[model samples]
Target: MDEYDFLGDVAVAGSVDSFDRAITPFLSQAFHAKSLLAIHFHRTRLPKVLFRWIPDKTLRQLFDKRYEKLGFMVDPFFHRAFLVQDWEACLLRDIAPDRFESSEYFTNYFGDTNMVDELGFVARIDNDTAVHLSMGRNQGQRRFRTNDVVRFGQFAKILAPKLRQILINQPADDVVEAQPLDRRFHAMAQARHTNISIREAEVAALIVQGHSSRAIGLKLGISGLTVKVHRRTLYKKLSISSQNELFGLLVNYVGADA
Candidate 1:
């Protein structure tokens, strides 16, 4: 199908619910991607998924059930979409932080996906919102090459502008208005004991997302020792002894919200 037909189907689908059936299959074949996930980002509220397709059942289940709630915080592609402020296809390994493969988030949540690589399109609608078109290579598929990324980038020059306009005109569901993650994170942690501070809650959020103490410190602009102190304190406050327990608590928290 041509670009217009592809986008026409997307627009006619109305809301994001139909996106999987409308655009995912076409894009997958066009890009030779094993999985595709289209997400609409809200600057403050939770993002809305426009479309999702994964060939692997276990990986798809993990993405739907846990990624948005926990693993997303550590996702470089997701974070970069906000920072890039432009349309481009980005490779995951090129942008991933040092020691990322060794991090708990990757070892646990991300590792479970069995995906070999990812390339994402950041379609910035404005300062407040953006749409992400992410395509991935699963374990058995070949990795995206430099030339392929270049082609995708060239394609973005066409795809992004059209998509931005389509999104503006079609206007999928409004982004939910809600408190920032840190505040809400703190509130949830305090359900058992209201001793978690806002900063500690921030630390907890990153921790659950699979950041190491050192990485968390770097991102938060503090020393490794400070991160350790905060980690210890929050662990005591939440009555959790290990990262596994903390993850379980947050998983339950997200499930409750659902």
Candidate 2:
């Protein structure tokens, strides 16, 4: 079994802000890197800003120009892994390469660029969106390792649930009905579209029905710890960190009586 196999319990219950906080300190511990940053694309038609590193005005202008040249604005449902051979040329090409090269399944799209010598991953939030995450190590610092990428992927996997809970568990315009997604919450919607198993959905429904963790465990014929794990996974998948947040989101988006 893969290291993440235990996460299958994500199908049972929800509400896990404490768990999310619990795992964050390990992000740095799990991945060795010169730098790591994550930016959330909350809304569209606004500036595709960065919460982490401060870009100089000149660099910011160049980044903006790159976005315009990209032909596609950031939106949800976009996933790309990049390995850069040239940094300057990447700005010229306007395409971010996927970083996970060891996995045959994770392909790199922009290889001809002359500036990149490392890898990165970018996942957008909307079709009309202009959000992107472009993180990589310089040629000299530390070559991007598969294990680092794997750890980042794990962090992404965990972060997904929290984001999902936050988006779907509310009436926020950005969080639309799962059936007819408008492409705004593509990242969150896509997780629900795929990954979320039927058993998991059954668990979520039960949680909404006011089932306790122990009761849910009994109903599913699983242990209470298993139920607890599932609930945490669900919260992460839904972008929810707390029970109150889950209730609010379900009441707002799913029409579940709050």
lDDT of each: 0.74, 0.39
- The top-ranked prediction according to TM-score is 1
- Give a tens-digit lDDT track for model 1, residues 1-258: 776787677666644556556667777887798888877776776777776887779989988877666456567766677787677678888777765666566777656888888887887888888888878887777889988888778766766665666678774665566445566667677665666888898887777655678988999999999999998998888877887787667657666766
Question: In model 1, which runs have C-alpha deviations exceeding 4 angstroms?
Answer: 1-27, 67-74, 172-174
Error of 2 at 12 (Å): 18
Error of 1 at 189 (Å): 2.0
Cα error, residue 17 of model 1, in Å, equals 10
Give the clash count for each candidate.
0, 42
> How far off is model 1, as Cα RMSD?
3.7
Candidate 1, residue 238: CA error in Å?
A: 2.4
Q: How accurate locally is residue 137 in candidate 2, as Cα lDDT from 0 to 100?
A: 39
Cand. 1 Cα-lDDT: 0.74
Taking all chains together, each candidate's TM-score versus the true structure is 0.79, 0.31
